[model samples]
Target: MRILASLQVRLPPSRLFAPTCPTRLKSFKPLFTSPNSDLPLDGDDDPDMTDPVKLAFARAEAYKRQKLQAQSQKLEASLSGNGGSNAALENPSSSANQGSRASQVSAPKGKPPEAEIIVGDPTKFENIRRRGEEPEKDDGETEAYRPKVKTWGVFPRPMNISKTYGGGKVIRPGDILETKEDKEAKEQRSRELVTAYKSKMGLDVDPKLIAECQKSLKDGNELMDRGRLNQALPFFEKVMKDMVFESELHGRAALQWSICLDSLQRSSEAKVMYKKLQNHPNPDVNTKARHFTFSFEAMEFMKVKSSYLSRTTGYEMYFDSFVDNKEAYTSAKTETKEAGETQILPYVVFLVSPLFVILLIAVRKSFML
Candidate 1:
C-alpha cells in the first residue's frame, strides 16, 4: 500500500498539469501577438509593411525631426561668437524658420502634408560704384592697344552665287542689272556642267529609274544618319544593284554600303568591299578606300599584337605545339648545362698526362741503368 502511494506521488498529475500549462499559454498568447493579428510581425511577410504612402510618411517625420534638431543647433551656434560663424548662423536660422513654417502649414482635407521648403538667407551684395571724379592713370605702354580696321567701305563684299542661295554682287539704287543674253549664257553653262556630272556618274538611265534610285539613296542616307544601320542596308543594297560598276555614283553607293556594314560589325564583308574600291578610277574614292582599309587593319593589328603566334591556327593546336616546343627546348638546355658541368677539367688532364709521361721515362732509364 505504501509503494502504491509513493508511485502515485512520484508520477505527475497529468490531467491537472496539462490543463493548467495549456491554459496559461493560451492566456499569454494574446499579449504576445502582433497588433494586427491577421498580419505577421516580420516586415517581409506583411504586404502592407512596404506601402509607399507609409514609407513616405515615415521619411517626412524623420526629416522633420532632423530639421528641428539642426535649427536648435544653429540657434545655439549663433549665440556663440565665431569669425566665419556669422554668415553660417544667419543662413541656417532663416532656413530653419522656413522649415518650421512649412511644417506648421496644414495640408488639404484628403491630401498628404506638402514638402517643406528650407530657405537660405538672401545673398549680401556690396555696392561697388566707380567714382567719376577719380583720375585715370596711363601707363606708357602702347602694344596692348590695337586699332580696328574697317572691312567694308562703300561697296558691299562680293559673294559666290554658286556656293550659296541669295548670294551675289549687292546692287544699290541705279546699279546696272544683268542683261537677258548674260542670263541665257549662265543658264547654258549650268546645263553643260549638269550634263558632264551625269556622264561621269553614268546616271543616263531612264528618268523614272534614276528618280527611284535617288529616292532609295535618300532614304538610306537618312536611316544611316539616324543610326539605323540594319534598316539602311536594304535601301543601300537596292541602289548598289542598279548602279553601274566603277562609276562615280556606284563608287559612292559601294562606299556608303561598306561603311554601314563596318558599323554593323560585318567586318569581313566590309573589308572585301573596301578592297574593291582600291582600283576605283576616282582619286577621292581610292583615298577614302585606303583610309578605311588601313583603319580596319590597324584595329586588327592591335587586337593580335600581343599574341605570340598568328591567330590563323586553331587554339588547341597552336597552344599544344607551343607548350611542347617550349618544354623540349628547356629540357635540352638543362641537359647541355649538366653535361658541361660534369666534363673533365682541362687542368686535371694537363697534370695527369705529364705525370704518366715522366713515370714511363723514369722506368725506362732505371732499366737501362
Candidate 2:
C-alpha cells in the first residue's frame, strides 16, 4: 500500500497553464525505480499543485504584456503619422462591434483611395450622344409654327412703277431722242453707215441718194420702234426703191417693209413683198421672216375691228353735246344781263321824265296865272 502511494499522479490546478512538464523534471528523474524495491516508481510521484492566487497573478501578468504590445503598436503607427486609431480617438463613444461603421467613420482621416475624378473628353462624349441619342429638348417651338420664307414666282405681278435709266431721265413712249452731239455728227454717222452698205453692194452709189436713204431708214426705224408701222411704211418703201441692187440692205428693207405694210393693213402689198423675199438670194430674208412670223401675225390680228365702235361713236357725240351746252350757257347769261339792264333803264326814265313834265307844267301854270 506504501508502494502504491509512491505512483506518479497528475493534479488539476486552479492556476494558469504552465509549459514545463512536471513528470519530466530533473529532480523527479530517480523516481523511475520500482516501488516494491524500496525506490519511488515513475508513476508514484505526485505532480505540483496549482494555487488559485498564483493562477490569478499569472493572468494579470498576461494582460499587462498584451496591453504593452498594443501600446507599442499604437506608438509606431502614431510616429508614422498614419492616423492610428483616429476613428476611436475622434469618436470614442462609438461602438467597436460595428466594423463597417468604424471603417466608414475613419474614411475621411486617411487619403481617400486616390479618387481620380475622370472627366470624359467632351468631343468624344458629344460624338457618341449625337450619333444615337435624341437631341436636347427645344424651347417649345415646332418647325411648322416658324415664319414662312417668301419667294418670287416666275410670273410675278407686273410692276406699274416707272424707274429712271440712262441717268435720271424719265423715259416715255414715242419720245424723239437724239443721242448724238450735233446735227453734223448725226449726218456724218449716217453717211458712214450708208457708204459702208453701198461699198458692200459693189454699186457706184450717189452720196445724195445714200443720204436720202439713210434719213428714211433712220426715221422708219424710229417710227417702227414706237409701234407706228403705218407711219413708218412710206419711209421704208422709199429706202427700198432707192436701192439699185438686191443686197443684204435690200433684204433687210424688204423684210421691214413687209412688216410695216402688214401693220398698215395693206395685206395685198405685204403679201407681194413676202413673195419677193421668199425668192431672195440672201438667207437673212428667210431667217428674218421665220423669226418675225408671230409678230406679223399679231399685227394682222390687231387690224380686226372691235364691236365697240358704235359705243365709241356715241361717246364722241356726247362729248360734242357737252361743248355745245357750254356755249349755250354763255349766250343765255349774256341775254339775262341785257334784259335786266333794259328793265332798270325803263323804270329810271319813267321816274325822271314824269318829274320833269310835272315841274314844266307847274312853271307854265305859275306864269299863266
Clashes of 2: 7
- In order, the Cα lDDT scores of the candidates are 0.65, 0.61
What's each prediction's TM-score? 0.28, 0.25
Model 1, span 90-123: residue lDDT tens: 5655554656543444234476755644356434
lDDT of 1 at 293: 84
Candidate 1, pairs of clashing residues = none
> What does the lDDT read for residue 238 in candidate 1?
85
Q: Model 1, residue 195: displacement in angstroms?
A: 15
